[model samples]
Target: MTATSSPPAAASRLDHLGLLYRDAEEYAERCAAFLADGLAAGDPALVAVPGANGDLIRDRLGTGRAEVRFADMAVAGRNPGRIIPGVLLAFAAAHPGRRVRIIGEPIWPGRTGLEYPACAMHEALINVALARHDAIVLCPYDAARLPSDMVEDAWRTHPVMLDGAGRRASPAYGDPVATAADFDVPLPLPPAGAARLVFEGFPDLPGVRAFVAGWADAAGLPSVRRPDVLLAVNELATNTADYTGGPGTLLLWREDAVMVCQIDDQGHLDDPLAGRVPPADSVGRGRGVLVVNELADLVRIHRRPGGTSIRLHFDLGIPPPS
Candidate 1:
């Protein structure tokens, strides 16, 4: 009965729910109950999870149910950096006055090794991002699939935990800013074969795009994906050329099934949620970062005392024989 009970609406501005499950049945029962509680309270609900999990939740909610919003996190949140701005905050902003409920499954066994750290950072940052918002966000973790350490990290990031037994406060909860700050992993070095280009002014943007196109073709990137990579690179390079008031360096290389592009500049990306959120305009401002996130298969940013380095990944299958 406790599992089905709804927590007080005004109990907290942001309720971070960490759902730990061992099997599919357990996940379904708990998640369904949570959504049902939200619906009964007249709160708008959003469920963003992987494809299969979304199907399970939708099935539980029944057919022709129009109250709930659903999105495939695998596509919407492919870059964990974008989840906070693009998915969670966007939904919460759309429904202004009333409390909103979100079921977000960002971390799963399917995440790549390079993506796990960013995913973990995103989890930690959520606590800070939504601390003042009227929202209840449930972040589910598959204990059976993920490492024990990651499960432990979840406890530190989330303020509450929910399961078959019921909900409870997480004793391991800590300052989210501090927790996220600890996850500043350095960007990996580009391959030796990486081609480098330097651009000094906005006038150089066209040249930057041209450089990216040439490298993209040599890397065997499919024509379909080349445009995305070029756009991403152009956006980052433009940010450097315009904002930093100095030359920016662009690097390109191929590393097994993927094309890697990195842009370095003296500018600092102060806002962690910059590119993740959609911008109002197309040129200048944070729109470039948003475009980069939307285009790149994976994006990694390293900000140090000196400058910022952003690496963009594009998945390109093996090249055809010459």
Candidate 2:
């Protein structure tokens, strides 16, 4: 996409733009120009993209990079669920009432099949999350590398599309809420050899920790990360007991080089955006899910009328078999 001019100021407070670019040079040039214009207009700016692309944009910005907040999307946004609360909204909240410019590339070519659904959900939710906010978030996609369906999703999620063809309204844009609901379908069943643990209440919490630690060791999760995994499960399990009235199931397995921990409770998650935003009260049940999103590498949720299943994915630091 060419950065010839900014989106019109009257086009909603949250000017979410979808940029489909051909290659690295195109990505860097347009993104740098977007940030530069924001900076020149005295808008607080942020750039969160993958490492190599971020370096390219940083180099293109020259000395202007000093005034912007930069984050490694690969790390800060490992779980697409966390990008809104931990990155985008957090940046906007820091500077109240002021218009902000952000270039956020949440979906890229290398995203795994298991993670793509969450990324799409994230893209759709961005519309709802920033509907009334004074922020211009530019999201980029690699039209040259990503699959056709993924590119199609860019159209479904963003109301405006910007490419070499120029900016225009997306005729394919669907209601963001409906799109998010469609993606909230059930996750696939775990493999036959996966391990399972059942807990009744707070009394069984210790056993839950032991169960996670054993699998973390077998999955070769490093010692430092073991605590995070444990904390995530503990919080989820606690929520089960506190909110769902006990008797939750925990499933653990390793899919190639990634460790998976899924928690299933017999109650529904009434709030669709429970974990996507930070809780106003520290002691709220929403905090548990928020913590899990922040701690896990990837988080996928399947919530239905009778039950809710949340899966957390963590890399084992081992190469997958060829």
Candidate 3:
């Protein structure tokens, strides 16, 4: 999770935005018109709308670029993380050095900050994707619903514009989403072996840890990093069960520089950022996310129509199997 709040890295080549929309239809129509211009201008683009809003984008653009309905995002597709960012990354890759634009809503035009973490995740994923591309990226959203803090943060780095009605605004820029298509976070050589652990919902924590530790040992990984991995997964998996209930699946694998752990549950989160969110809790939930934020190098979350999924990527700097 490379939030806007995170300490500055080598200065990402990304842009942020804050839009104000009067209505969903107006928003969709104007977005379609803007994208049409962008396409004609020779930039590449990807469009995302609530499942129901696909028609709006399609009707306006008439199909030249790759488009994905937000409905396809599901817990089953957790291997590469949530569908939104993955689709955005894929679209950006297809264009290669061209601009990419993603529309935030489709079903019903709405306010951003009012929706919870999905909008935030939407922005964060786009930021990660835009880190180094020469392409332009655009996002249209309702400003009234957004928190002032988020709006301020997004406006700080991009060209924001107010819409036709005094009620709408958006960011216009050339930061493309293609940057992350080739994103490779460097890590140590992967374990000598790899295996997949499948489970239905959340298993008993102790049992899950034992399984993971045993598998890691067999994979020729160092024992020293085991507890960190084990505890992190346990706390997160437990958190998953507590929030999303007990009926889902989890997958583990290694790709490039990361040892990936993903958990899926049949929970269609209405609010996107509910899981990794900061909560003011004496019950420890807020603290748990804080810990996950501190320990994991990268954390991505997405929700499918039937459920929600979370993926955590751990860096490989620790010793080999101890």
Residues 1-322, candidate 1: write the lDDT tens digits: 0001122344358888899998888787778888999999999999999889987887777743478999999988988888888898889889998899999999998798899878888898887677657999998899998999889989888989876577999999887766776676897778786899988888888898888887766656788887788778877887887678568889888777778889888887776556654545563356787778778878888776778888888877665445
Using alpha carbons, what is the TM-score of model 1?
0.88
Worst 10 residues of 3 by lDDT: 176-185
Give the winner by lDDT: 1 or 2. Answer: 2
Q: Compose the digit string of candidate 2's lDDT tens values, residues 189-299.
A: 899889999997889999999988887776677777787889999999988887776589999988877888999988677665678766566543457888899999999
Per-residue lDDT over 114-180 for candidate 3, one digit per residue giving the tens place of the 0 to 100 score: 2323334445445544555554455555556555555543543244544555333334333322212
lDDT ranking, high to low: 2, 1, 3
Per-prediction TM-score, please? Answer: 0.88, 0.90, 0.42
TM for candidate 2 is 0.90
By TM-score: ranked, best first: 2, 1, 3
lDDT of each: 0.81, 0.86, 0.50
lDDT of 2 at 148: 95
The better candidate by TM-score, 1 or 2, is 2
What is the number of backbone collisions in each predicted candidate, taken in the order shown?
Answer: 0, 0, 20
| Candidate that beats the other on TM-score, 1 or 3, i.e. the better one | 1
Candidate 2 local Cα displacement, residue 268, angstroms: 1.3
Question: Candidate 1: global Cα-lDDT?
Answer: 0.81
Candidate 1: residue pairs that collide: none
